[model samples]
Target: MKLHFKIEAEKATSDIDVTIDNLVVAGWAGRDHAAIEHHIEELAALGVPRPSAVPLFYRVSESLALQGQRIQVVGAETSGEVETFVFSAGGILYVSLASDHTDRKLETTGVALSKQICAKPIAATAWPFAEVADHWDSLIIRAYIVEGGSKVLYQEGPLSSLRTPQELISGYTDGAAKLPDGTGMICGTVGAIGGIRPSSNFTLELHDPILNRSIHHSYAIEVLPEVA
Candidate 1:
């Protein structure tokens, strides 16, 4: 074994998304951590499940005072084990094959992958990134984990109906999920030869099952834990 100073370095990887019954909510400014924590306690007293699949949310957004100001709120209803999302508030609820959402990724100039991921960031000036969410699907994310974060993408596509609760979990049938290149895919297969069987692809078929619902997302993502 080769040893320098006995220090081991880990490669950057973006991988895996898991379902959580509870999620910490944050806003443009900051998350009301204390308020949300208290709410969690209240839900616990009310016998809310330890983990929830269909989330019911109550929240307010910009322009509360002005007349016609809107609020964003939504909930999920379950009957006979079938669950659906009900979004209302801010006038309507909608779902789609895709929607616009913002997030961060890492980019560098010297490397090939970085060059592609940060294509525009390289030019002196360029059209603002058009398809950003797709970046989460293809870009290497762990690069930012050690040093910093990068704001690089936005996603937009046909949005479903407004004024009605749209379904985000329904309609999908089956497909192979193409994860980003550096996705931290665990649980690879093994051959009878007992060698490393590697793959970054997942075969998914949607049914009325919890595993299917949990794996379906409007967007693709791979995330890492934070430093303490």
Candidate 2:
């Protein structure tokens, strides 16, 4: 089956189609000298081990819902903000925003399974990586959560906080073929503002001041009843 994603093309007035075959998420990708130790400590408190490498790749399904789509989750107490990198088969790389919508409760049990629980939501548009490569470190990622009626800043930080896209792609390849065409990777996210918590709605964006453009996407979370 084919997977489709929306994109605001450079020439098109409306969104266009961006197809892919695989989706991956890089984890424990913090670039700080203490990044590994920091994540280890963070997850250890919750009973998880720190990965051996700074950037570990988790391959997710390509089948994903687009922006504005309502995704259902069971026991998903929170959604982490993230930026998704899209690899076009023709060799064009683009950047978009996404929420690695996860089930926090299940996270305590299994990180991969917890990640597989919800339908990932991604932006309807994307920005060419070539245009932002020079100032890539300046790109910013910001996410907001709708609790009750107001939107609260859930996470916000610059791309510099995490390993560069090239570094991540290299690590993920690990002496293998370069990330093939039709591959989409969700770059790791920054720390949460007030700790992880549930939200009825989630919104995220990737801002590039150098190019004066941003990629944005939002979705509503409909928590399904848990049945054993």
Candidate 3:
């Protein structure tokens, strides 16, 4: 399926000349190099192995990515917040919010398989990279999980919590493979408050207070019937 996104360009120009083939997720991309252990400890509780190094890379099936208001999963134990970067074929950059929705059960067996088993949800709205480049560190990302008919803060932090986009892109590419046009990368995320847990509905946003604009996306998780 071709994923189309609304571009908020710096200038009043309409452009839609990009196709995405590679969708990559950069994990352990945090700036607090020392805190990586803490984040690892958090996931290790769920049987996820500690990464061999920082900035671990994983490729999810671009065919499984979704941007609508609702997404269906077989069995997802929890979701995490992340800032998504979209690279245009022209080298222009855009940013949005997304949830690396993962199945905790499968994660224990294999991280890549767990990531693939669930559809990656992203926001339809995106902001031009130039708009917030000067104050990129000030950008904030927050998420809430609907629990017992009320929304509770699941994760919250600034974009600076993780490695900058430049660093992550460089690490992922290693100066070898340039991020091709229409490449979409879901950058790593911060820790979850109150510990990671499951929820039926998940909402998230990428807020740039400097520009006074934000990209928001929310989706409900519907479990499919299991053959017993």
Candidate 4:
């Protein structure tokens, strides 16, 4: 999958088209073990099974990466969680935002299958990893969902809550300092504010307090009727 993104750096802003050959979603990646277990319990309440291991990596199709304003799903039991997206291209790493939109109902059957069935929406803009390497933990990720015709905060937390990009890349690549070129990974997410639930629209944001800038993206969900 080819994605066009604007690279925002301290010295320059350039447009780069990245070709992603591999896409992986990292789950249960919280820095704190207790927090990770809390998230597992949160999902368990909804019938989702606990993962066999901590920080599990689920390989997904690169074609599922999307940069559109809308998406379609099979039912109303799907929801979105904001996550930090890291991409490697031309030997350079970039940080961005992505929503791990998932099917809750199908999630009970299989987490990987539920993820594969939904489109992963990502922001079209990215920041160079080197630019924010010093204060990576301060960066915040948040999401808002349209609830009862009003936009409400769904999830919010600092990147520190989850594992760092370097940590995740190393974990994924078996101690490699960086991911292979033409690869992307969606890091783990924070817990939902009011619990996970389906909504017609979902918005994601990655805020850099030190830089005073944010990358924002929103996508509307269209639920298609199920015929069985």
Candidate 5:
């Protein structure tokens, strides 16, 4: 998948296009072990199986990465969670906003399968990781869902709530310093506010308070009938 992005660096901004062949979704990646367990238990309550390892890495198709404002799902049993997206482009790592839209029903069967069942939406803008590496924890991530024509906050927390990008990249690469070029990963997200539920539209945002800027994207969900 070729993704075009505007790289917002400390000094200048440039447009770059990169091809991503490997896409991985990091799960159970909370910085606090207790919080990680809490999320695990929460999913378990929904019938999703427990993960075999902490910070589990699930490889998803690169084609699933989407920049559009709308996505189609098999049924109404799917929802989106906002997460920070990290990718390497031109030898430089960049940070962006993305939603790991997932099938709640299929999640009970297999987490990996559920991840592959829906389109992953991402923001077209990104900031160079180096620009925010010093205060990465200060970055905030948030998600909102439209329910009954009203936008409600679904999730909100600082990036510190989840594992850092360096830790995630190292864990995924077995102690490697950086992700291979053309690889993109969506770091785990914070728990939902009310609960995980489907919505007609989902919005994701990544705010960098230090830089006084944010990346935002919204997408509508089109639920298609599941004919068995």
Candidate 6:
């Protein structure tokens, strides 16, 4: 399964191009679930999945991956809310106004998606300078890597507001925020025809909407399917 997504802008409007390369998998007799799931995950190459025999979608939101343009401008130079973009694991898109800013760099942070585990943060190197100067309203703030296992994690943030870096890094509670939890049914029996299966060596990637490029980091994670 090949899953490729590319977002770009032309004529001042953003465009999203998504492609899912569907492939067929042969289920052999006596093969365990791990072996099959491993091969299946490879099909999508990772994040993207084929809707064969099973149904799944990565979360997304307008604030995550979608383009950010002013919903309504109050007055020029008044500094309206900053639009943020996000890609939820559920395949939904988020595009809206809200931000975590600071007077300094590497000194601010977004709220954790959840307390169960600390989500990885990748602040935009081009932020404030590239994104802000270029007027790119949205940018990716964090990325996370979780052990695969037919699970779900809920994210709560993009609080539809703005605050100082000091407040966000310190976990301020006055504004809207994303509080996520990953949960899901593990593996079903071999005869199961439909279910979400976790992946080995799970990896996460984040992008800067304004810069239109991936952040300078990637997180490769290994969890679940423990071996002795």
Best by TM-score: 4
Q: Which stretches of candidate 5 lie over 4 Å from their true place?
A: none
Per-prediction TM-score = 0.15, 0.88, 0.92, 0.99, 0.98, 0.23
Measured by TM-score, how close is model 4 to the native structure?
0.99
lDDT of candidate 4 over 14-103, digit per residue (tens): 999999889999999999998898899999999999999989999999999999999999978999999999998888899999999999
Quantify how close model 1 is to the true structure by its C-alpha RMSD in Å. Answer: 22.6
Q: Tell me which of candidates 3 and 5 scores higher on lDDT.
A: 5
When summed lDDT is taken over every stretch of 10 residues in candidate 1, the lowest stretch is 119-128
Ranking by TM-score: 4, 5, 3, 2, 6, 1
RMSD of each: 22.6, 2.5, 2.0, 0.7, 0.8, 21.0
lDDT by residue (53-166, candidate 6, tens digit) is 421112222122211221221111111111232222234332222221111111122111111121222122212222232332243333222335443221111211222222
Which one wins by lDDT: 5 or 6? 5
Query: What TM-score should be assigned to candidate 2?
Result: 0.88
lDDT of candidates 1 onward, in order: 0.17, 0.73, 0.76, 0.94, 0.92, 0.24
lDDT string, candidate 3, 91-159, tens digits: 667776678888888888888888888888877667777778789889988888888899998888888
In model 5, what are the clashing residue pairs, if there are any? none
| Tens-place lDDT digits, model 2, residues 82-196 | 6656565456676677788777777778787777777778776776666778998899999888877999998888888888878888887876435678777888888778766
- Clashing residue pairs, backbone N/CA/C < 3 A, model 4: none
Which of 1 and 6 is the better model by lDDT?
A: 6
**Residue-by-residue lDDT tens digits, candidate 5, 1-228:** 999998877789999998989999999999998888878887887899989998999999999999999999998899998999999976889999899999989999999999998889999999999999999999999999988889999999998889999999999999999899989999999988977889999999999999899999999999999999
User: Could you arrange the candidates by lDDT from highest to lowest?
Assistant: 4, 5, 3, 2, 6, 1
Off by over 4 Å in 6: 1-114, 117-126, 133-197, 224-228
Candidate 1 overall lDDT versus native: 0.17
Which candidate do you rate higher for TM-score, 3 or 5? 5
lDDT of 5: 0.92
Write one digit per residue (lDDT tens) for candidate 1, span 129-154.
12222231221111000112432212
